[model samples]
Target chain A: MGGDFGPGITVPASLDCLRNNPDLKLILVGDSTILNQHLGENLSVFKDRLTVHHASQQVEMHESPSKALKNKKDSSMRVAINLVHEGLADACVSAGNTGALMATARFVLKMIPGIDRPGIISALPSVFGHTHVLDLGANVDCTAEHLYQFAVMGNELVKAVENIESPRVGLLNIGEEDVKGNEQVKTAAKLLENSSLNYIGYVEGNSLNAGNIKVDLIVCDGFVGNVALKSIEGAAKMISTLLKEDFSKNIFTKLAGLIAYPVLRSFKDRIDPRLYNGASFLGLKGLVIKSHGGADALAFKTAIEIAEIEVKQDVIRRISEQVEKSLTLSKSA
Target chain B: MGGDFGPGITVPASLDCLRNNPDLKLILVGDSTILNQHLGENLSVFKDRLTVHHASQQVEMHESPSKALKNKKDSSMRVAINLVHEGLADACVSAGNTGALMATARFVLKMIPGIDRPGIISALPSVFGHTHVLDLGANVDCTAEHLYQFAVMGNELVKAVENIESPRVGLLNIGEEDVKGNEQVKTAAKLLENSSLNYIGYVEGNSLNAGNIKVDLIVCDGFVGNVALKSIEGAAKMISTLLKEDFSKNIFTKLAGLIAYPVLRSFKDRIDPRLYNGASFLGLKGLVIKSHGGADALAFKTAIEIAEIEVKQDVIRRISEQVEKSLTLSKSA
Candidate 1:
């Protein structure tokens, strides 16, 4: 029971994914009764590929991280993560309270060696393919050292998932200028410059979305990253809303909207928010994908896709090896 | 001499503004030779409304703030700000180096009493109306006190410029939850709660563009504000580009795009980045509008319109008085 629809949306999406990918198997962990109601007649069809593991407790969105961790011993989110921890599943995906999910996942899987805290990492649909941005509200008050580590993990993640030999890492800042930013960003820039990564110096937010992607991976503190992510979401929504409003203003425009519906729909599909749903909890020992709490069936399916790709690429092993290498290099240099 | 295009764009933009607004008088500050070349024979036609105030030096974009202040005594940016300082112009507008402009403007006009650093405030076209956001790349690493001050300045700006009494103020954070942001944002939330302003508490980045318009003024430190601003710009561009690409995929879609071109054009015009060109430097003794460095004539014209409105409203005086009153109320409480 996670996200707004809880098991209602998750169950159907998982069933769909399992049907599409022949080798995929899913363990649906939630209130078995509620999930069964949604899966009603379809349970028999997917019985061979799916297992229903019941968890009585659920984490509320308002619950504090520590509170949820202490009280909810049998939450679906926790049990799901436990499956990954015990090596029963390759990865787990959840559409639950972010703080609760992060706290529980960190507690169960633990951090990769040399990783202090697992960061929230997600890919944004940029003009040129996708840009991976890390620490999306995982650690709001990040230090220079934390930012540098995020760059290392994010670099390795893109290399593993996308098969990019050396992904360009960018330190996100207010401006492109070397002198323009808070003390933490400036210090992080210095660290990134000396590190054995393809550091692209400083990148502003516009560069993140522009089709001619300047940097493959953008790194910043959770606060900045989260704000930037949400801002892009808001802008895209507002623009589309404005277009619909304009098209509805008159009969002529309405006719035009009708004639152009196919093109508009195709355009909408390209920039659909659902396509970029899951955010990985990088630096964790096991793969954990956090779907948006308000995600629907389609968005949840996209989140599951992230898990499928990550598991296929062995993202955890790659991130682990890179972290160890970077740590050793830092100590020596 | 000033921005990227120098007098080529600025001179024509000023001329257009002068033609539109009869009461407007413009003093073009830059190299006289370049200004005359751009102005050509049009100088005689606009002679009554325009004057050329030449400055020999120009501040490059990469110049350090301190270096620009000390070395560029006769810089166009400095000279333009001096006109406002000497009561020759009600406000000064420039598209020059931001750091140099801020340093020169602050040194020339000084800050209002109880106001620390002046914030770069601008209007973003939101769903409901335009929302005012401030400290956009002014003070990157700000304290809670500084954030509170930005709220006061931004609140006053919305009131004075937009004529909205008791405009709702929001503290921008990673999440709307009171516990979600860094320590600085948390402390600032408490301060805003206690202040006399109509503080609506924390707002996330999506809320900024979402037409619901929770608050009229969104306040944050410069770093977060800048990133949010750029992210919106990037997303808008990306969405439009994707829409065009979708339309060009096939013959039927191309015809649909042709039929819907007018409605699409109007929609694009509504959210055109040129319309939101000027950013006000608030909490200073005098008004100063910072135009985009790469702004074209149309965009620079919009920036000049901002200066005209602020000057007409006596924004500086109103901001100073309200800031004093707010500070006094806080001290007593």
Candidate 2:
């Protein structure tokens, strides 16, 4: 009902997640006939842990967010999110149109008190394991206040998910210098500096992947964050393409590639984007993870695992308390 | 008197350029003693083509752009730009502080007739040869009008430097849809659409390095452009580091790496950043190129070659004419 493959990908990914986690239960929200067809023969095997919540409609990948929000009231994405809001489900995961998912999530789940907007936070593969980045196309034109909120949410996510007591949060800017970025960034820096969070001042774009400077969370407006994330993806793609083309250019290189296959495979595994597939919609009242639309079964399973982790960690409650504390501190001051 | 290596890198790079292009003459502007020391006994060998123009001061790498413009009037960076202003040189190339160089160039040569601000354009290695992107940290807070000017300048640059009659100009955004980006980007897209330039609507960040979509020039605000460029550099660095670590994990992998050395070298050579070292300051009355601050002798020579090409192609004059024509057309409409 979502993503490129719809039930074809999600059904199998759900089964894999159930296999990996004994306590996990999944309610596939889509046309019951198709969901049951995919969940075939195994229906009786997993009947206790798996169920189908029939949805009347589906959202297209290219559909406008507002249009989907207005028309697709019974879409699988909407039904899944509704289950979360009704307290029937701990979290919702979707590999669907990003804009539509976000719009519907905002409309249905609403925002957490003291938070103005919902930010999409995702972990990117970095030198030291990985670093979490936020506001990845959630709100393109964000105010300084919105950016400060993003920093807070990103900080809490890392603290809860990664088990860090006090995560070092860095505001993404063009330069480390105090005078380097635009007015929005400068104001946001001031807000983060005064806050009680472990703010680490400014970090440049290169700091995102470089190991020299360690940062737990990188915060920026959605516009800059989206551009930076996509640029990294493009670079990784270009490097892989170039490597393949070079290795297959002739017979000699092909032999060398075959010899070096083990080392190359390990390298690819370390930097694989699929391993870091899930993106959380933070600042919302309920947990919702967005998997890559073109993700395979393994990648989508990763997204489901991320959702399970967040729910177990009570990420929503932690972020809500932090936002309330910061707001109260500012008001009293 | 600029960059990390100063005359040590620039002097040798200048000699290499002089050796390669017999018709080219270079004016080395810095402290006479240091310049002569680096020039060595070669001063007599290329005496006619290379000469030192003494400057009393040097702009430190960390100096503020405004401070450098005001207090360092006799700085080497300022004097070199002054030479271009007075028509003593066809173009100026510097491995100096970007802020100092851009500020001094703007102060001395000023902006072109119909352009509001100067943009920094550099070529990025893409699947289809290379793509030129502009406003790479020149104006962090740009208006819609400023973005339009960047498109015009970037368009003119590719036309002159790459010899493309009509470069496909793409406005960099988070999404390709008309309603997907911020207000400024949306307004700028309209301006580009109605203009005479070959505007190809909006392009996402992945389009920057992806080969599927062919774009000659990508235009965005300086803040976005700088972040995108640095993100690519960070990703490339991360991939290379991972490759190195993977190849040296064990004796078996090390042996395999040795066998694959030739293929790896060719891959590295194809994506080397040195080949695209120079970034032009477009929409200025005179030409100035900024080389990477940590560039080696070989990389510095590439910057000089870029400057030579721009001078020969009359990029400044072409940009000025294009700006004037666009302004006239908009006013009439």
Candidate 3:
């Protein structure tokens, strides 16, 4: 994985991955010493399945993506992406620096055919179970066409991940009206309305969390999607903080907390960022799951599971077919 | 007030406003019959203080700002703005259509001297109390200059409403780094850095909810602010829904709920959106409060109290001073 916390998180995740999927193979592409220190005495069972490749440098999270890729030849992120490029690894997962990971992926794996930009697709745990929020942090300034492509990619991803036959796709707009939002959103609505996908025109921001809107996939510019995703996380954090403060207020509240403990735990588990950290750097040639950098073992294991599923589903191949067909039709039209 | 619910909410709020400030005079501007119908028996104590304007047209929530203003000549919103325009009302408070209200205010009251777009400013309840979030739903395609003006306006509003000195204003960017985010954010950051205001430079999306980023005021495009605001509401709704579902799951949980009723009520009271529904449409010539349309009497009362404080503080004069200074400096520079 291409991240600052590559081996720190990956070591535990690798262990959990092997335990959960006995046949899974893991190639540690970071500094062998650091990886071994974490791996330690538990390396006996998966010795045959594990391979260590020495990658000396680690990319800092704040480093410029292009500069990091250019300077750090043996960086863990670059090494991992190379492995995927060379067909040595089925998929690559990272919780490290997002920009560096995205940059390296774009540079090494390259964009899939007919894809304009490699959008980051995140799964937000909505009331309707799960909604795929696309372009969470990929294309900041997106056009109408870019959003259209995002819908296509997001739709394909929903199907691959959620096992939906035809996941409903909604264009994120200011309102449900035919004419709402900025020029880009208005144009995107028109394009989405004309698209072959299960298009549910414009959707308001409230529909995302309410899960009242039946769409499994919601597409928008990275600016809006990223803000929306982070806002939800921030709100959840704020609410949890408030609840904790309330519970710790007095003896009565504390005692009440004991009684309400199960419900609070369920709330935490349901909206936990760690549990829902398997974001894909979608539209890339190879499968890449970007888990939260601070994700614990459970979350990391989930990311691995997601990666494995994407590989089995031949997600890239299917996406390529759909995108290419759509592109060809657009060109002809 | 400019809204339909203003009469319903304002009648009780007028009492609270009067109780707090005996000198407060409420010119209830709406359909006289409807206002009296709602205020019936409760009008005795403050019957002498209330003056009604018979406005017939009510702007629908879905109507376009311009269309609503052009078509609905005798709208309560239009009349409310006109009161400010003719120097009859100190401010206009509304729980009506935000778009129509904004349009009416812009057309009648006009922008404060240097303000390009009068932003919709409101204090969003954050983990760390409250932060002033501007452009809640006013200007959509905001330029950097527009955002800078919003910062100035937001800084003034926070000072007026919250009694904070030198409220640190932050430009809502994709990342905190000077190098991150789209061109608009970058441009806005530069303007903020160079401005005379207490500009804190860039802040991330997550910071808006985290309550850790210690800035009193945050300025961004309406799209980002609206999306972020709605997402927070969505998260809260989703969690609340989940909480209700889990509580109603079994007899035991239901029993726990009954036992912890008082504590839960306290928790609900603390986080209730009803108590925090007064959002000010900043940058106009006069103060305009936009309460939630679904507001009850309690929320409406709070809205009136909010309006009283806003008018007492002379928010418009303060905003005018800041904007005038900004305009003169920019022109000379």
Most accurate candidate by lDDT: 2
Provide the lowest-lDDT 10-residue window in model 2 chain B. B324-333
Q: Candidate 1's error at A297, in angstroms? A: 0.7
lDDT of 2 by residue, A1-333 (tens): 788898899999999988889999999898999999999977788889999999999999999999999999999999999999999999999999999999999999999888899999999888777889998989888888999999988899999999999998998888889989989899999999988899989987877786468888999989999999999998899899889999999999999999999999999999899999999999999999999999999899999999999999999999999888886567567
Cα lDDT tens digits, model 1, B157-248, are 78878898899898888877767888899999999998889998788898778835657999988988999999999998888788889889
Q: After superposition, how far is residue B25 of candidate 3 from its true place, in Å?
A: 1.8
Q: Candidate 2 chain A, which ten residues in sequence have the lowest lDDT sum?
A: A324-333
Among the numbered candidates, top TM-score falls to 2
Candidate 3 structure, TM-score to reference: 0.96
Question: Once all C-alphas are superposed, what RMSD does model 2 give against the true structure?
Answer: 1.1
- CAPRI class of candidate 2: high
**For residues B248-277, could you state the per-residue lDDT of candidate 3 as single tens digits?**
989988987776777778777887877777
Greater-DockQ candidate between 1 and 2: 2
Candidate numbers sorted by TM-score from highest down: 2, 1, 3
Candidate 3 lDDT: 0.80
Please report, in order, the local distance difference test score of every candidate based on alpha carbons.
Answer: 0.88, 0.91, 0.80
- For candidate 1, write residues A159-229 as lDDT tens digits: 98878999999988987777788889999999999888999888888877983455789999999999999
